[model samples]
Target: MEMTDLRLVVATGALAAVAAAGAVAVWRRRPRPGVPLRAGAVLLAELLLVTAVALVVNRAEGFYPTWAALAQDGTTAHRPPATPGRLDATIRRLAADPDLPIAVPWRPPSLAASPGGGATVAVPAGYLRHPSWRYPAVLVLSSPADGWTDARMLTAARQDAPTAVVVAVRAAPDLDPGVLATGMPLDLQRDLRVTGHRWGLVASDHVRRSARDVAGRDPGRFPAPVIAAGPGPSGLATGLRAVAGQLPAPLAAPAPVLAPSAAAHQVGRHRPPAHGPVSGIGLRHGP
Candidate 1:
């Protein structure tokens, strides 16, 4: 059973036990007229207490059922299949087509068994013409409910600033599939988005591998010191990766952007700052 279901079950059992105990206590009182009312009050208070405790525990465990339905709604929207070797072929084609405008949309690579199933990569402007130019890479994590597309990343890239490749990783894998399958009511699924599987470490590895693969295919197109960024839940993941020394570039994002909480910032503060040439364009938050 899912954590939420399990918690509910346990709470129900606790409530039953409390009711039974109250009944027994009242029986032992031996015919006192007020005993029934006292027992009912005791049972009601115990039930509420159990429910409150369950809610608190569920929140602490990050088991938000409300957002699950919304997340499910967006999960299957327009995910193009990534056939084997297709990514490499696409990159080569883009490189060869030097005359093609950078504004054109490039297909994202299909990540193998990725927590989010796949990732969207946005190449920098002039990538086709500047064969020898090495650009920094940025990995942007997306929210579980609303996945990002390569076009979104391209829009976020600055035209005047030094161009860098942007990769947006989806949070689909981090969400619980069970909740999606059940088709839970909208009201119940309206809480907050919960983290199902712990995909942080594995997802980071996938990002590094992706970076290496991109750099390897085009020779000098992408370089080291990748910047990890995001907003909302993904932003928190990005900050955690930065704090853990996974990202070699300093974390940067606009003030209005949803950065990691103060506690997360504290964790990242103690770690050594990422080293390398910082990108002129940091994290940009928008639609």
Candidate 2:
């Protein structure tokens, strides 16, 4: 038999053995009436719990062939123009297979140094709404370590418009509060507010505060509609702050809030690697 089949058989046998032992003990102790029956019941309950946990963990890890999707941590994305069409097909496929909508990747803007020692923004891809590219674009603020991958972006793209582009912006660590803000800026505080929702390593609100403080000084230098995603203890505290009270909107408006006219654009081409995350960091993407 194949190794995989053998493993499955062994696992099944083990479970059966456990169940059989529980049943035997339960049967034998019932007439004798003692703590043994209680012990057997406990064992049975443990087995059931383990089974349920195993099933769930397996499914989350993509064991379900019919609806499996591995969460990606930063994979290279397809080139622009071609990306939209491919994303459309992928989203459609995922939607049908998983019976759920998918979020596709968006062409992000390029990052440059701002005149005020912050950062500058350049849209490498032209107007997304232009006949050339019909999808809308979203601006993201996070870390470069959590880079884009074709599968991840397509899976997360908005459903109504599968072609929408996502622009994820990463901040520099040096821009943290210790570096940028003498006092916390509202925008910086906002970035700190939503850090709790992260899954992995997270940055401190002070860091985000500093970065945003600097970025905010030259708001025009960055893209419009910024969404921040952070991870870790500090990030969680920030998320609470953000939820407890609204922070001043970032320098840019989130794409959802843009007017139809604002969403429209003239056809243009963007260079690859338009934006790079801060060195040696991984950040979360925003909704």
lDDT per residue (tens digit) for residues 54-121 in model 2: 64443222122111112222252211221123234333443433333333332211122312233211
Model 2 TM-score is 0.23
lDDT (CA) per prediction: 0.36, 0.30
Off by over 4 Å in 1: 1-89, 92-110, 158-162, 173-287
Report the backbone clash tally of model 1: 4
lDDT of 1 by residue, 1-287 (tens): 34344445567667767776766677567666485587686777677667667655543333343333225456542221211122333555655454332333322212333464445554544554444222334434444443334454345443312244444555443443323212111111121111111111212332444334333322211223233453333333343333222222222321111111221233334322245223433433211
State candidate 1's TM-score: 0.29
**Estimated TM-score per prediction?**
0.29, 0.23
